[model samples]
Target: MVRSLKNPKNAKRKSKGSKKEDGSSSSNSVPSMPAKVWQPGVDALEEGEELQCDPSAYNSLHAFHIGWPCLSFDVVRDSLGLVRTEFPHTIYCVTGTQANNAPNSIGIFKISNISGKRRELVPTKTSNADTDMESDSSDSDEDELDNEGPKAPVFQVRKVFHEGCVNRIRAMTQKPHICATWGDTGHVQIWDFASHLNALAEAESNISKDASTVSNQTPLVKFTGHKDEGYAIDWSALVPGRLVSGDCKNCIHLWEPSSDSTWNVDSKPFVGHTGSVEDLQWSPTEPYVFASCSVDKTIAIWDTRLGKSPAASIKAHSTDVNVISWNRLASCMLASGSDDGTFSIRDLRLLKEGDSVVAHFEYHKHPITSIEWSPHEASTLAVSSSDNQLTIWDLSLERDEEEEAEFKAKTQEEVHAPTDLPPQLLFVHQGQKDLKELHWHTQIPGMLISTAGDGFNILMPSNIETNLPPANATA
Candidate 1:
């Protein structure tokens, strides 16, 4: 069974003001979120709510919710290079079934675009005779979501269909309607929503009596080369169909689309790491360059043309390196997370043949699972941990001389004082366990979404506009 929810009260709240220069709003007020009526761990829905029935007997119970991390910031350009204060009104969530079931799937959800203008719900008359009519009305609304962009803030589960259990799923920047996923199946699949999203939308909306019909399961493209199920996959930003994927077998493969609609793969996998290549990323500006982190506690940079050796390598962590993120704006800067529960930032220009880490973050108490650089700001980054928490870090904040002096007086930790202190932890998202991955919304600067064992969470810091300065203001 599947469930959907919406609170009319939340949709009617007005946006405070225009975005500020620094990407935050001048108004400091954070609109309060609706009270969570569904208690944690409860899978049942309230009365009057319709239950979506499916013969597959998939587990639909999960604790999914949203949160506010901060009140505000100034405005900045989005990943699309557009300056906007709002995010899209949809989310793609990868969901899984119970331990005994193999009902893995991805859900398309329509959510309130709370980052901008207040979107209100249309008032409807309630009548017992209108029960079936209401269901049809809901279907019609979903069809509109597929045909047109969001016109109002409507919270609903648009679709849920089976896809195998994928470890990572990423929507493309160049093509938002296309997404790529990889996992234990040793296959990297590319899905094109343009070919089927509208079809699914039309099928569901046209349902007069049946709502459980399954949609097509075919993917646009599939690539197989890894010795094991891939753990990481990324599409290049500068090049359209160029992609890279790594797996538990310590092998990395580069993929390109051929003229025949088939995938051309690197015959020889990029090899160097002694352990599983846990994560990989393509350089935003460099078409031929990419980076990968491994369980071997090392991070390596490779050029597609020269697969014989890494362009650069580092002993990044004391324990297994789980993930690494390239600074989108700062080409030479990168951040890495490890099983030791530490976050380190390094400048490739300054890294010599030594174990010199420029900065460290120690807030997470367990292994870090994911790390990402904010698309809007060069100095801002986000990370998730096995400790069931998501944290946002801003490197722009600097420690004063007094704090530096106090730290030196307190402990003689090293011969030389650390060059930089830990970045400021801007937000901490709790109440979830074993978070697997987290990502910043490309269109919305401050909004983020995360996936965990319990379910998925869409989080936005309160007063996200306050993070930026006014358009007329100078920073």
Candidate 2:
């Protein structure tokens, strides 16, 4: 779902125009100012000197803001395969400006190469429009002429969706395009760079030479199945035009986009979770199956090919399950976190009719808010808690043969070990008075991003290092 972090200060002005006596005149006349375009990576920095920040100074602080009073950040690379300091390639923060009802106006900044200079990079507005156009055209021609390989990184701060305050934002893909999940007026909306005009110019340059496909400007699509607040959605990887969504009403609806310009409900309401389904994830390998975790203290697996009942149900927690994730690399693996101060991983293949448990984790003292599997490394899992710390686990280590034999022979009490070594803990920015949400960047595997309740600070993943090799090496 795509949502604009920028608040509309001119909403009243927009509303005022709607009240004009002559509707026809109002409709025909274009306003004096051009409509503000929604650009995701476009920066709002004030022009002039480059801004900088020190990563080491704040690295030890556990909690600190990179740019005071700025809202969003992202990370990207340049043509030489070098990480650019001026571009916030991974994270984004949304700080609402309180002036002129600009509760949604946001400042976008990026982490800098200089450790102490993680500041905002503002773009300048030039009156020489023709010159700029020529420059852009020349750049396009150069890109077209060169067949060196992958293109350089291009980043900008884009204003995606502007409505009410966005409660949650998740990326479905990465550039040459990106999609953001947004919650607005009890509906779920997905905004994509592919849907916007500003993105067309960028997309045209990025198309591969041997491709036969043409890009389409589909704008944004709104999914309104949830009568109340739609909480979560998972895009289908196997089936196109299909999505699974959960809402506050404890219902899960499967949707398919039909040829008639409307999304149709493909299945009946899949109901079983006693409370709100906070999250749902589709299995990367098993496209017909998916997992769902709810606030009702249960996790269930559903098969799209089957009927309404869950294929297998597990009452794996003592409290509300806040989040759930499927290991894209592991076909049968499922992870769920709960308010009971614990997280559990279950193997769908190991589930037996009377077995009450599979594998249990007790790491956090508070509810586990988010859990994700590392995209690059399958066995590595990242979990975040209300305690404001992120723990990374390496689950690749194999057990000793003797220990495995003993564990297989022992009872549940003897097999379960509570004193096992803790995962590597990386303390994220915690000093924020209120923490709202945390997410990992889909494109940049190791990058983590978080938002606070006041919408003040957005923190990027600590210890970020570029995987791109040095520029001088030939392909």
User: Top model by TM-score, which number?
Assistant: 1
Give one digit per residue, the lDDT tens place, for model 1 in 1-475: 0001100000111224433212345464544222222211222544333222110111011124322111011111113323335343343332222222444444433344322222112213344344233222122121333334333333433233435555566666666556677744677777765533443334422334233333556777777667787667787889877888888888888888787655788868889888898888898778999989988889998987875568888888889988889988888888999987888998877867475466788777688878888877887888988766677788877767786566555543332322432437655556555566777765554667666655565555432322443442211
lDDT of 2 by residue, 1-475 (tens): 1112230010111222232312233443434222221111232423321222212212111123322222222222212222323332323232222122333322222222111123112223334443233222112111332343222223223333244444444434223233334354565654444333233234424333222222333335666667666556676656655678887788898876678644677546888887888888888887688888887788888997888879987887888887888877676777778886688777777788565445677766776766777655566667756554455665654446675566445522232222244533322233333233455544443445454433322233333332433433311
Q: Which 10-residue window in model 1 sums to the lowest lDDT? A: 1-10
RMSD of 2: 19.0
TM-score, per-candidate, Cα-based: 0.66, 0.57
Displacement of residue 136 (Cα, Å) in model 2 is: 35
**Candidate 1 ranges with C-alpha deviation above 4 Å:** 1-81, 86-100, 113-163, 199-213, 353-356, 399-423, 463-475
Model 2 scores worst on lDDT over the 10 consecutive residues at 7-16
